[model samples]
Target: MPMAANEIEALIREGIPDAEVEITDLAGDGDHYAARVTAESFRGMPRVKQHQAVYAALGERMGGVLHALQLTTAAPAKE
Candidate 1:
């Protein structure tokens, strides 16, 4: 079973709390998704770690249910 965009976003929010997440179905397939996550907590973290946090949020679903995720993550812009 493929993951829904809202499900993915909810999971990320559950894990990251303050994260702002946007999910898009790239190929109009439930299996392929692109996520843009921005959070203040991501500040000072390395990009790899940022991605790791999102992957962790998805847990086992990443490899099993969700096939492909094109993820982009960042800390909020300085204001």
Candidate 2:
């Protein structure tokens, strides 16, 4: 089964409590998605690390329930 957008958002939020996440289905199918996440936890982290963090949030779902994710991560914008 494919993961739901809310489920993906919840996972990211679990990992980064302050995350602002937007998930969109890239294809009509639920297996592919694009997620843009802004979180304080990403501050000073490298792009690869930021992506890794988001992936970790999904646990083992990366290659299973979630087939593909196009992820964009950013630190919270400075006020």
Candidate 3:
């Protein structure tokens, strides 16, 4: 089964409590999604590493239940 947006957000938040996550259903099928995750914890980390963090948050569901996630990650902008 495809993953729900809230489930995805919750998983990411569980891993990075400080993250501000925005999830969009890209295809309206509940399978394809786009996630923009902003967190202070991502600071100083490379883009790949940041993505890895979010992936780790999702655990084993990445390629099985939660497939086709277009993820974008960034550190929060300074005010």
Candidate 4:
């Protein structure tokens, strides 16, 4: 089964409480998605590590039920 956008966002939020998450259905198919996650907590982390954090939130579903995802992460911009 494909994961829902809200479910992805919820999972990211669960892992990073301060995350600003935006999910897009890339292929108009539930199996493909692109997620943009911004959080202050991501500051100072390498891109790979930042992505790892989001993947960790999804547990074992990354290549299973979640299928494909193009993920982007960033620290929130300072005001």
Candidate 5:
């Protein structure tokens, strides 16, 4: 079974409490998704670690139900 966009978004928010998450069904197939996650905590975090965090949130689903994910993460603008 493939994961839902809301499910993915919720998982990301759960992992990063204050994150602003946007989940998109890139292929309309539930299997392929694109996620944009922005949070203050990610301010100085490395990109790889940020991606890892999102993956960790999805947990075992990464390679299983959740097949492909194109992820983008960033901190809120300094302003």
Candidate 6:
């Protein structure tokens, strides 16, 4: 019951509609992933807080369906 990349992306999008997400399969097993997400919602949030936001989007799946996620989150870059 590994989590798919699309599933992860969709969940993030559900939480932050304007999110720009790049998901990579770190292990090629669908269980380990790395995600780089940029969103306005992350503006002013601390790094840990930003990561928590993304984790919260996954709910209980964090330990079960989704094994591991390495995340890099930030507000969208200034033009």
Q: What is the lDDT of residue 57 in candidate 5?
A: 90
The residue pairs found clashing in candidate 3 are: none
Q: How accurate is candidate 6 locally (lDDT)?
A: 0.91
Residues 1-79, model 5: lDDT tens digits = 8899999999889999999998889999999998999999898899999999889998999989999999999999988
Q: What is the lDDT of residue 19 in candidate 4?
A: 96
Candidate 5: regions farther than 4 A off: none
10 residues in a row with least lDDT, candidate 4: 1-10
| Worst window of 10 by summed lDDT in candidate 1 | 1-10
| RMSD in order of candidates | 0.6, 0.8, 0.5, 0.7, 0.7, 0.8
What's each prediction's TM-score? 0.97, 0.94, 0.97, 0.96, 0.96, 0.94
**Per-residue lDDT of 1-78 in model 4, one digit per residue for the tens?**
788999999999999899999999999889999999999999999999999999999889899998999999999889
* Tens digits of per-residue lDDT for model 6, 1-79: 7889999999988977888999999999999999999999889999999899888887888888999988899998898
lDDT value, residue 46 of candidate 1? 100
Best by lDDT: 3
Q: Which digits, one per residue and each the tens of the lDDT, describe model 3 over residues 1-79? A: 8899999999999999999999999999999999999999999999999999999999999999988999999999999
TM-score of 4: 0.96
Instruction: Give candidate 5's total backbone clashes.
Output: 0
Give the higher-lDDT candidate: 2 or 3: 3
- Report the lDDT tens digits of candidate 2 across residue range 1-79: 8888999999999987889999999997999999999988889999999999998989999989899999999998898
Clashing pairs in 6: none
lDDT of each: 0.95, 0.92, 0.97, 0.94, 0.92, 0.91
- Candidate 5's error at 54, in angstroms? 0.8
Model 2 clash pairs? none
